[model samples]
Target: MWVQRVIELTGWEPLGVSVDWAVVEGELGVPLPADYKELYEAFGGGVFSDSVYFLGRDEGVSFDFLAQWRVGLSVDQDGKFGDVSAVDPYAIYAPGGKGLVEWTPPNGPTSTSG
Candidate 1:
């Protein structure tokens, strides 16, 4: 429903892409949110309204979700991004721990995490 709303608002046709969730979750060391997975499946990777860039399963691309997540963690750990107060200091969400995870590209107004 939410994805449909996004489609309606953005006039984006769903790509209906398939992703290897097992591989993605395995690499991330945690299961991704169902809604996120659904969104990915519906839309894949691309920018929305030139503002929000949704990372997807595409490897080595600017919109690759997994690569962005790794880069986010690396940048946070290296203290390179600067002023990442929006995200937790160095925590990443896991089985019992709470932390932030990247779902969008970094820099500009396009990046986002949760």
Candidate 2:
């Protein structure tokens, strides 16, 4: 609803392609929010107001956002501390970690771990 409102106001256009959730979730090891997938489906990827840059599933681009996120995970998992790890890197998601830790589902809410 809010996203649709923003789109209506800003004239943001969709990328016009269906997303592959299976591949995405399999690679990320998490289930994402439905609204986020809807937004991604409506708007492929790009920056907004020169402040927020949206990540898309475009694999051809060198600056793929999803690819970048994976890189961060790799760095953390490898324990190569560039200047202190921003994220645990080795931190496991809920059901494996401490308790119900919140996780960012790309552009969605921090889903409560079950």
In the range 6-85, model 2's lDDT, one tens digit per residue, is 67987877556677877777766667677767777787776779867666577655436568777775666645534434
Q: All models: lDDT? A: 0.73, 0.65
Candidate number achieving the greatest lDDT relative to the actual structure:
1
Clashing pairs in 2: 14-42
The per-prediction tally of clashing pairs is 0, 1
Give per-model TM-scores: 0.56, 0.57
Candidate 2 off by > 4 Å? 49-51, 61-65, 79-114
Residue 61 of model 1, lDDT score: 66
